[model samples]
Target: MALPVGIFALFVLMVLPIPPLLLDIFFVLNIAISVAVLMVALNARQPLDFSSFPSVLLFATLLRLALNVASTRIVLVNGHEGGNAAGEIIESFGQFLVGGNFAVGLFVFCILLIINMIVITKGAGRVSEVSARFVLDALPGKQMAIDADIAAGLITADEARTRRREVTIEADFYGSMDGASKFVKGDAIAALLILGVNIIAGFALGMISHGLSAGEAGELYITLAVGDALVAQVPALLLSIAAAAIVTRVADARDLSGQIGGQFADPRGWLPVALILAAIGMVPAMPQLIFFPAAAIAGALWWTLRQRAARPAPVEQPVEEVSPDRIDIADVSDQTLVTVELGYGLVHLVDKDKGAPLLTRITGIRKQLSRDLGFVLPQFRIRDSLDVGANEYRVLLGGLAIAHGTAKPSRLLAIDTGEVRPGHGLTGEATRDPSFDCPALWIDPAARDHAVSEGFLTVDPSTVIATHANQELLRNSDQLLGPEEVRALVDDLKERAPALIEAIHPDPLGLAALTRIFRALIADGIALAHPQPLLTSLALALQKTQDFDSVIDAVRADMGARLIARICEPGERLKVVTLDAALEGAILGGMVDPGTGQPLIEPDCGSMIAERVNRHIDEAKGPVALIVQPPARRALAALLRQRASRCLVLSINELPARQPVEVVGVIGADNPAHQLPAPTEEVQAA
Candidate 1:
């Protein structure tokens, strides 16, 4: 739409008596580019990830605006404005404001654009809006604001309105460059019309009184100017403002949270546009001044008023050098002894964009960070801080660790401290690392424990964590222990519970089971980290216990009878025709077994399992390491989706069903924790 108007403006300028300028060409280019952009945006199928758009637009706008300034400055400062220095810049810009044939054509086009925009606005308003997702740590982070509303359970529902909208008001930096306040669409149109009417009317009056006195000619120009101001500028001003107001109101409604102070602002722009448009429409001949100040001033005033209304009340600042009531750092977050151990090497922190991912143990808990990120350790109360260059910043979490690396041209994002959940053994790991340069954050001691349950981080012992109970010792365990010792250990476990420990045949059984279970919960998009350890421990205890028969029954009980029944079912099938029909969305009457018609596994208990299972299913995430082929896989998947206490359905295939849960810790079957592989095939044959 903007392009069509621009093209018509270009076509009109080509034939117009007045000379065209570079500014007019720039406007043409902008309209052309905007049209192309709109087409592309409409076709993108995926959710628009607008994370980088704002910054990119800001850079582009700034650069182009600078270009505009330089162009205008060079032209005006050198006294090269076709007219003169005082009004040449204005005249140059005024050419782009186009009236007469250009104005009429643009006016028709803008009307169409407005109508189409209204349709889009109304239709889009009816569609459901998707909420933005944020990145969080897998393990819980220390709380920042103990929001008052959270304490009152207000955040759970609608108490806290969604504040996810982002708004950017593109200010025309060319205002200062043009030696005028600003220019908007209305201003450009108004200016064009002003030029058109003045030129046409002035020519007509001059011809009409060919033999008249100079005073008569001057009177004609004055009459044209006054008549335009009263009959046209006044009404046109009101109309332009009304249009802007309507557009702004609709915009505000559509983006309640995004109406920033400067959004939909800059009436100076509209004023210019309005003046140009009005000037073009009146009496064909223009006046001498041609509404020189009218449009720009009016638009500027309107913009100022809009922005002024939204400015926030100023915050009262403390004037005294020493704040008498200022509290100590310890007042908000008492220092803790325990610290989280982030295990990434110094290299990781240096190349943090890639390294940050590699260094953190982000489960789908607080943040659903990928597994490869490793254990992102946190500083104690006095660890790292933004105190990078501060005169002094007393350590908050343990001490700081600033691993040295060559600086980049610019450091976009840097996290100096881990969110420390206060009580969970922070002080124990609060050792110092002066090598690191980042902020150290601390939490209230009591706060950490209350925030996290044990199961959240209770990962399998096989998977190598950044900082586990033992680091160096575990690394050398393989080298120190002979093959015979390892064999003996395996032999002993097999002998003790031959049935349960039938074999430790290398497989992703443990890892797949664990990952699968959690993955399902994670997809549920709900919180469910609490039962991981409980389930893992149960799997281990069952594997180790001597009383296999009794424990299997207990396992069934712990798993809930329905899950057992499902797993014990005969075949694989995709039961849920849709996600809504899955156990997550199951209700009593809708899905009762046909024969018994009994609420498929009693309604009350089903609800409880659904809640618990949903939570776990949402958390377990990873690869399909252990493939369970055929009926077995199908049965397991069915059980997990429909009846499990807390489980996810990884592909149920040839993978062994009785594998211990510890496998989850292992990345794959060829784990460092597992026994060495068998000898070559030739050697086995011999």
Candidate 2:
């Protein structure tokens, strides 16, 4: 309210009767002050002092001083006596200065300057020190440790499991980031205050001007300068802390990382935008009427465009006519992996800028395989593949690693819809199609020779079948059989026997497929009982029909423990996972990745371990008790606290060997066991 009226009064003074010399002197003082500040800041190696801003003030002051001086000198020399005509008019505009009015204005400006200096001097040094300290830390991960301890006969496995889950929950609600949530509170408050103050000041000035009947509004020019300079400082501090907090939290979240937050969470970007904008707004007479709001509108539009671009398509395109073939048991070969490049069936050539998904058909194939199979399937790990730009995934039921065979690859495809087309296939470095040169295998060689000699089958040297038929034929043969019958039969298989080795478990593809199926079953809460019976049946069937040992190994892993237990029934292994209640709070809260610090993985499992451990280990006392209250209301405080000398670590390998020892937490907890808070979701997961 006072600003617009004040500007008018100042304008009036510029034309009032007074000494021209004093008005010029005041202007000169302002120029000298800005320059002095700049020179000092430069000498101190401080950032340049408001380079553009002080220039604005400097130019205004100098221009006004020059005009006043030019009029004074011209009138004095060009006119009669010592009195100059033009200088007289300039003199009339300076009447306010003859009184105490100018002195008061100068005093007010000086007071404000002192306050600014006090704030800067007090804040700059501390901020620098804090900034340096944050620069030297790393992100967080201790879940592996917690898991190990559980396996090591220290803490209870169930407790460890609970803590890991807690960690995830806490991160979901509060963010795995260090200070993000806390900083938001402060930022929101400060931003609101700034917005409120500016709006009120602008409106109040408008009303005062309306009352004055000058069709003029309050002078917000100076108010804007002061408000911006003052209000901007709030975010400068708030956001700096926020950035630091995010860096800390995320650093703690990641592991196998060089440092936490590496580059992703750095505050270098956000803080500057706000401060820079505030500064531009503070320029005196900069005519903010056009650019300021326009920049805001432009930024919003750009962000909206980018977001629209990033969102993925709602669903995969519908599968239409391609080929008509029902791939059967013989199609998938043993000890072989095949990947077909599903042609960019939808669009032969990708339109880089215009198309959605923006990836080649091969990428789409991988996505499908990943979706149908599992993200971390063993089959993917072991098998080799190449996309032929054909819209299909085919299986090789019979193929050798280094031998050539005559067989066709087949896949089930919809023949009715003809949108997607198939192209020739490529393998390794060579292109292959219906007549490709690739190695393959069939029935067990031992059984094959016996059958041929016994005159049990017709001769077709080029054909090979799955091994199970050969095994049964040999077993029923009157020709002699031995204790190592299966092994001898396998050794006799000549088609690709030289390249075959017993696989203990499913390869990456097999693993992924199984996992995907398992996940799907779980999604609908399907039953999951002991794997032994199911594995045994699959193993026996495959062994009898295909002579494949993939299922055999699967069953072996499932029942190996039981068989081992029966053999050594007196001594059984210990628990699976565990944790210590005492070391709840001592684990580090926030650190960045050692490599590319991003917040620990999406739901940093380790950070939760750190949180839980820290909480368990209180400040004053040596140990505390952990408690889990019923009806867990929130993820934040789910576990109860307990006190002890050290958390009891246990051994998962030998159940009888459970041991006690502290893992992570403060050395001595000050609070009572009951006072300890529950573990955060992230902590439980860790």
**Highest TM-score model number:** 1
TM-score of 2: 0.18
| lDDT, model 1, position 675 | 28
Give TM per candidate. 0.22, 0.18
Model 1 agreement with the true structure over 426-516: per-residue lDDT tens digits: 3222222222334322223343443233211211111122223123212222222233323443355455555433322122234333333
Candidate 1: clashing residue pairs, number? 103
- Model 1 off-target regions past 4 Å? 1-153, 156-161, 166-181, 184-212, 236-365, 368-686
Backbone steric clashes in candidate 2, count: 141
Candidate 1 lDDT score at position 205:
47
lDDT of 1: 0.32
Q: Write the per-residue lDDT of candidate 2 for residues 339-378, one digit (tens) a residue.
A: 1111234222222333212122223333343343222111
